[model samples]
Target: MARLNMRRCPQSRNPSSEKIIDFYAGDYEVNDSPIEQVKLTVPITDNPSEPVLTFRTWVLGLTSCALLAFLNRFFSFRQNPLSVGPVAAQIIVLPIGRLMASTLPTKVYQCPLTKWRFSLNPGPFSVKEHALITIFAGCGAGGVYAVHIVIILKAFYKRSLHPVAALLLAQTTQLLGYGWAGLFRKVLVDSPYMWWPQNLPQVSLFRALHEEQERPRGGVSRLQFFIIILVSSFAYYTVPGYLFPSLSALSFICWIWTDSVTMQQIGSGLNGLGIGSFGLDWSTVASFLSSPLAFPLFAIVNMLIGFILVIYVMLPIAYWTNIYDAKRFPIFSCETFDYSGQVYNVSRILNQKTFDLDVGAYNSYSRVYVSVLFALNYGLSFAGLVASLSHVALFDGKHIWQTWGNAKSESEEFGDVHTRLMKKYYDPVPHWWFHACLITSIVFSLIACEGFDKALQLPWWGFLLSVAVSFIFTLPVSVITATTNQAPGLNVITEMIIGYLYPGRPIANVTFKTYGTISTNQAISFLSDLKLGHYMKIPPKSMFIVQLAGTIVASSFCFGTAWWLLESVENICDKNLLPEGSPWTCPGDDVFYSASIIWGVVGPGRMFTSAGNYPEMNWFFLIGLLLPVPGWYLARKFPTTKWLGKIHWPIILGATSKMPPTRAVHFWSWGAVGLFFNYYIFRKYKTWWARHTYILSAALDAGLAFMGVFLYFALQGNNIEGPHWWGNSNGDHCPLATCPTSPGIKVEGCPVF
Candidate 1:
């Protein structure tokens, strides 16, 4: 390789420091706005000789991976689950990395036979090395989506799955995404337009961790600021975490109207519209949607609009009017219902042997009806998926098309300054590696489906179709996730598709959905981390290797942890059987089970048809399909209506996607905090926003994580419940929120209207 015209880092950070970029002076200049902003945050420099996959990197990296996998998977069983992502607290770990670097021997030795060399401690822990470790952490930190299949099947449905099948399912679904990530990395990772807003926070934290910056006079440095906020977050979490858990959701209206069922239903943030309801706890503010401080302002606005429209405007009207017999059930719940205003007993309708729906039993018992909120979520999901596709195709189609062509030709020097540096110094990960991964995953998927008593019930063709659907939707869904920090899930679409085709097989429906949706989800996760690597200047192959290795380790641990818990903890997911205040309620798994009942046992054919109550929900598909068109035209028509261009229908419609586990208060508090930081604070204090915003997010996440783990082990783990009084008794002092409104309907604890 010859010495290239790659621009070196200038001594000063200035716009005029950029030099010799030929392509940007031409047609692609339109996309440079976002790329330019990225330059403001990511340093346009690289140190290629730094040893990335060293002894400290692997040991610390894999240790973090295994522990996080165990912690995340273990905590997920709790009613209010806590998930700590691997991206948090790079700054906090700087000392540990340094300690290992200092203590370990610096001796380099040759292998006994082969021409191989190794070292216990390489040079100083470089930025590249630390970034690589985080990548490994990230791969293990996330819960394996396939494990959800295992839990719901075994725990909820009481079905047995072969261990081999479960392991294969976990790995295939996870690795399938690797292929997609590699394919799209050129456009998604390398391209500046796909800025991947989520990565910027991690990037900010990385720079703060590794780079040395002189403290401003009379002002704290980034490191000092991070320490202060992290400690504050740590101390504050104890109040809500253990001492007074109800502080998590403080709805003043609920406090004011203790006796009124209607008022409580409207006021309860845990299960209602959450009007003027918010939280004092950082966990509550960040629940389901990590820290809202990282959410982009445009995303915050769009999601807020969608959330309000659904929760306040649409739901109140429907629930009050008894639409879908809403008054008979909780205003906000994942529970399915019968016509007599009772919870639907799915066991009575399912065949014990086949685990399929017994038609006669189902018909004789009652039609399955979800709450008004659940019904609307279904409708909105139908809209959100297509809305994403339409929005992406309409807004970003031309750029994607050009990028695809450029990637194929293999001659386009298409990337911002970061991509140019990577291309100049390191070997790009070969496309064949990802192709091999895709092929292997597909082959193993077939084996898992067929080799084990046909337990999965999905045919070979069904598996192929699921792959195609995932492939088709990955680009659009990923585009949405990249820009907005939220992606509409493919689970609903996949379940809906398989339900109609292969009805009465609940296991099969979930399996199909798992394969289709999880693969796409994993692909997006991989691409996000890759973009982080892109910004940090880690070699692409090293990142890929760590991701794959960490994924393998994490998948095994998630499966093993889940398997052990299921065996040891009797009556684990059974809420009625478990003792009061037991954290092992498996709330998210309950939602997954409810979905199985709706789409698999009863099936969409029966539930989403004219004979069913939710026939109108199907119309959302068309509504969402066309939702993006008007925005595109109006933005073009009114050139000066700049905000119109930013109004993304996909994000707006999918804003409430995480609702069942994530209640109105979660969105309410998250959106408020999001706007305060990303919008108001950002515009008012640009430099501070860039420097401290993401650091604050990391602090809250890390602080909450460390405290939650401590609380569980030191107190809750020993069956020693903290002091329980009025302040800690209930989430919002609103018992009647779960009550039914119909005259004769009776439910436990809820007032009868």
Candidate 2:
């Protein structure tokens, strides 16, 4: 194993310093060349032979995986859900790794039945091992969204699914994506230009942890700075998180004009555009668009533009203009309604025997209607899908083709330093390995779908078709996410295809959609982790084994947690049935249920066909298909004008993507922070910005996760309520924030219990 030389050269500290020696590339002028600019010169080879599959790795990995799985599922049920993203895991796992490295027994522990022996203490806790642990934790960090199938069946529909059957469905849906990701490693992971910029922060943190280096003059050490910030943040959150919940959504405008519904519509953070509202909670700001502190400046700007156009301009115009009779419905709601303005009676339209749509009942009842925001969400989703495909082809197609041609060639000089380093280890995981995983996953999925009491009702061929669609969309969406942090989701396209193919069965439609859409997302996530492993120089075979094991652990824990929560909480998705201040409101399930009704039950034919009530919605698909052509043409024709390249339509459409769960306040505040830090401060202090930005983001996330866990167990878990006061109440100070203003629309006064 080659040792990484740590001795400092003159060029190591500053890129612009004179008489600088280039360690990686041959000696060259210090003047900036975009391709030659090196952000991280840290050597890739750092104890390549260090033990990765040690007792410490397994113990920590399994513990964190289970903890994250539980926490993610627990928070998903909250009214304002908070995600424990990969960054949080990356930050929190560091000290645990270091502590274990120092304290764990060094003696090799041998398996009684086998010849294999593994040590608990891997010398000094190598960066590669630390990264592997983080990867394992990340695998289970997100609650399986496919579990929504089980949630809706039991909670809202009052249908029963055996625990065994539900667990199998959840596991199959989650792991299918891993197989897809393995198949696409060549394009998404191996290619140098697919930077996966989001991983840079973690890489930087890894270096900060493992590398032997002195702190800058008068500046705080990374670990010291991290601890200080984490402590302060954890203490501060106690106010908005528990004692003063009203601070989470402070709408001064609504407070001033309590009787004016128009003011509330424009000012309320929870129920409207939230133009004047502000959130004190860091979790609220970071929930929708990830932490502004972590995003690249340009990406943040693109998000801001899209958010303004969609939320501020498009949404308000549609609502005030009474498009889809928006005034009759709540301005921002995921719930579907009948034409006569009542909660949609899905039971009346669902055939009890088959769980399929009853055409007679659907026709006899009034036509279904959606809020203006909901209608726009579909249009944007459609437009975003087309835009992402076009953007990648026009901009990155040439580079992709060139990389594919040279992928296997040893003489390829265009590869990045990380790629070059990885090539030294010739033992690549063979293509057959990935193929085997895919085939096995498919076989098991067929068993789950066909074996059990027709729970999913999706045919084997439908499963195969969903997989094929996932394969097709994987490369394009992966390219978009690699270059830009955003992923144009496959929800619209998947739903459209399934709706047309298997029309009347809601369960079958969502099940197919889950396989098609969630699988692609999982593939992208897995690929991102692979990129992380690549950067850290973890052995490919080891990475493959650990990732597989982690997924299995995550699936088991997720199933157990979901089952427990559903059994414990009464009327999980119903606000009226649960206690008034209970945090068990399942908002995510509400959205999932609505989607099943719109696309699965009513379906594309009844919703957008000529004889349908919402026939005009059909134009959105056409509009989306043609929307990106002009932008692609202009950018291709005028390649020198760099400003034209900044316009990414997919990102713009993604801004208003999930309105029910996210508010305009999130985008506005997030963009403001990004503009100040990522754009302005970054330009002025490049080195300082590079050093502190990611560290700050990690600290904030870790602090929130730690505090959230403590609060949940201490107060929420034991059913201990905080002192009842105006500050601790649910709403912002104003009671009439969501009151109806339109004449003849009966006003439901805001309840202030």
Candidate 3:
């Protein structure tokens, strides 16, 4: 219950003024150390005549985007999903660009009417073109999220959804955020204080790629260092990525107590508390939580505190106390359960004709339940959402207010160096263009949701409501992401609202949640990319075009790949009909389907109200609302204690928000690496940390991505499985970690009593 590490003192100065003050251990050219480093990575120079959106950029960008989309869609279903981000394309396309520059004919070509001219190959692939292509490929790196609705509807619900309807749904959801992105440009992108910490690594990588080979101060150059680590990481990943999978998480406690189910449950990294667990795989270390090296020291520290409080402390207490019959379910699971700890049969409570919940069948069957871990995550998420708003209002209110007041009157007066340079050189993307995109998307979203057969189930009013919520939440969420590299979302809250308003309408509820949540998230993503472009001095109009084009291309490729797999592959996502050890399990979609049932069909009234098992869980909202009070008071009381304001409650609570999909080992390993690089190296060897930390992160990602894709096509796709051995089997060597501890529960793979 004690959330803050507080030392109460006499109230003196205003907390609001004290919040922005900080003391630095080392000298900084600017108030922000990270932004000062931006001068090092991002060049202050600009070449106005460089060819951007050239023939090479268009062709390579399109090809890379399509390929990345296909791979993400295809590989996402496997046991260990391989996400080939734009980083690989950024590295791979360089040599190809060089070759094209040297080989292709340089004959000039002109458009029929306009002064626009092009060639088969641009002179040399300038860093601008390289950045554009990489940004374009980024459009499809993770695959479209809205495709999940199509998945549950067809695969799980067995409903016949037309391909055109599916296509419309995908495109609209993905494109709905352009307006929001445009509107927030002044606040999120143009301002100097909104330094997006996440995009720094990508900027660093681009600079390293263009830097000539030269070892500064008798040390390896950035280019040489990247090559060395890239090769080493590629070679090392073979052990955990293929040859031996258990190296991902070495559950030493489970290894020591081989026969004890309790011990395994207490120690397993993948499914349990991860008491003595460790990992060697880069994928395991950085998969769920992204590369730890990319995050700043303050953010990492906040996340670690949150992770420890939730995973190691509260999770154990909740389980051991047997609260809400915790012993009857697995230590960590997203699956809903019944009284006897059996997986709830969702079909049993559904009305076949109307696709609504059957009240009669529901009365006969048992009430639903989630694991203690899942329940806690939901509560913490509730807290995280409000705390973010409160934290931002208290800490960042003044800067945001000032930005809003004079953001347009005079750009040069209030802007930073990057903003000044951008404004002086390039024509800004007109505000009206963004307004048109927003309005048009809203009009089209209505048609898409309610147009064809009315299949999407979301009404016009509901879609408008979703937009309202998205509009309201974007600024706060963006502020959180812009500063701390963490985005607090409204996903859970959106579902809860719709589930209460219109219960037993699964598709409608999910559709509302998707638009409400992802619009904000997508806008934030676009903003991040824009900030990357800002740092690198890519023209705003060109960046805008690439983002739009990449989104359209990515959507098409995702739907095409998914539809093809659904048709050609036999019994996809059906484990019962597939051969032994088949990898098309659809774990993510299963979780999505469960959400539809819990918040859609079952409704929060029956599940989290008086009729439900966990009515008290709603109290988390109030708990989260007030969690930031103590920290603010302390900051105000002791203005000189600079670190007091750094206790970001939102980030700490949101740290473990992704726990079900992510395991305890993810945090443990991420923190381990982050401490070494961001904390220890950052303070001890600032220069080395600055040069090599981001290089190490980029190299690791690029190496694993290339190797993972190569392994899939070269080996796994051919049914050439890893050798049959102990190291390749039984992850974490903790088979019984998922077993329920209750006697006579009769759950599969558990003890009888």
Candidate 4:
């Protein structure tokens, strides 16, 4: 079973003690021959030799797609309808694809499949395979959170599509960048200066594949990887579930004295001894905190902005309005619209009502709520967008031109190299074919999307509107995603923009009015392109097909699974019934929706959108918007800083905004996945097989999520509608529940005591 190994060198240091195992066991080297150096160069399309290479492309494509799909699913974080499927494209999939490609003779061309004789071997896999894997992984990883999207689909599109299908369809929208990523990779990745922190895994994996055949052998390292997988799998599968149930909620433990202690000292108080460990997946707090990696830079600037906005801006305004008793908290929910019946219950009101309020609502004077701040933020963000764009062009025009110019040079060379590489190491799928496939897919989706009884039928006008908005925002959205990988509060902004621009139309209701908008197919295709540019190293022309194929596969499977989970598992989305204190609950909705509304209506203005109102986004957005400039300015200002200097700002800001200092588990988990793997598993062991650990982790998580969902059912006596674990309080005064029960009653584990 062990494919690679090693023995100690004769160095005098400690002979046996210095057990240096060869990590690059399966890699090949170009030094094998002069011809090998040029193996990647295919003949021009018009040349007689073109046919040979075309076939080879087919084989590589097919193989790469299949293996990647399997691995992506195998290593995914959650089997939920919306999880990002794979950890790294190049690390696991590309290496395996390259290994398979190595077996062919340098001169070989297309596979024997006569159906498409002129086509290259299609490589071992099609672009479809890779795209499908990537899209599904991303959606599966993140989709579960947006279950309401599925609910909308099922409630509206029941005839033609089920709830699960609707959920997948809604989720697929997030992947839209993949389709156009190839066209924009030059703007995103090829720029030597743009490291794209998130895409690092892709770079590593692709580079490994480009290595030559017979470079060296290190089987022992592979064996070590195998051992680690088994050990980790056993530990994760058994220990976390049975041996130490406490570990399941470890995130609470890690924050006990730190985050909780501070809260308690402030008189917020704690319910019990929290687990407080670094990483038990406490969705409630995790959603609010910046990601561990994006915290460092974000924290400093964000804290400054947060202090200014909360203390000086919103707090002062709040005090003057008397929205709260002496406490600095809001009197009502900033998430909802209606605030009529429960004026006395301040906490309940604050958790449920819309935050789009006039200053009068802030006053104890009792003013009717109005969307005053919302309009201001909406206006400002539009201004910010224009200003941001102009600033970029003004500041980075030369850099942009220079980057594109270099890309032009590389582009020409890439064509030849791509052709040859297709023959040698990959499969080439033509752009035209992919385009045709996409068109056909659109037509098919439109028909299926119409739904029975027209439950999910989109008005012709709304359909046109979504398409227009999608297209208009496509490039800009891609730019933001490629660089920052975040666009928080933007969706709410988009909704408001759309709502205002095209007044009185329920575009959100387009799930039924026009299922086409959220069908997941188009987005999957788009995300595939983004991924192709980031990872696979496939040429832009090739990405079209790659994304198209992936969309078809994922859309088919994802939708089905979503319908099953939602219909069978009742109230998973019910704010009160779901995980208590979790971000999935009603209160957490305040954070996301309020931020979006604030940004959407206020448009980054002084009241709702600026550093004074929403400091996190205002600071993070500004930093991200100015990253290219600072990166360039710093490069010039401190010429010596290079990676350390220009990068320090973006990385620090990104790390801070996304990752906070308090999140040790997030730090450790990422450190293990990104840093540890790169440094130890990828470096010390030197075998791509070590990548299996990611797959092992994903598989374990998927199983756990599935079991968790099932156990939830079991605990409720097979009643899917039963109360949730952890925060239900068994009917006791449930914190922030819609029905305000007294502290004495016991509803389940959620008791009033």
The whole-model lDDT of each prediction reads: 0.82, 0.75, 0.83, 0.35
The TM-scores of all predictions, comma-separated, are: 0.95, 0.93, 0.94, 0.54
Root-mean-square deviation of Cα positions for candidate 4 versus the true structure, in angstroms: 11.0
Q: Which consecutive 10 residues in model 2 have the weakest lDDT in total?
A: 29-38
TM-score winner between candidates 1 and 2: 1
Tens-digit lDDT string for candidate 1 (401-471): 99888767764467656666677677889899899989999999999988799888888988888999999
Evaluated at residue 233, the lDDT of candidate 4 is: 41
Measured by TM-score, the strongest candidate is 1
Give one digit per residue, the lDDT tens place, for model 2 in 284-312. Answer: 77777677775666678787888789888
lDDT of 4 by residue, 569-648 (tens): 54534455566533222223233334323333222332333323333334434544554565556567776654523132
TM-score between model 2 and native: 0.93
- lDDT string, candidate 3, 210-269, tens digits: 855456665777788999999998888788878998889889898888777789988999
Worst 10 residues of 3 by lDDT: 13-22
Evaluate residue 266 in candidate 2 and report its C-alpha lDDT on the 0 to 100 scale: 82
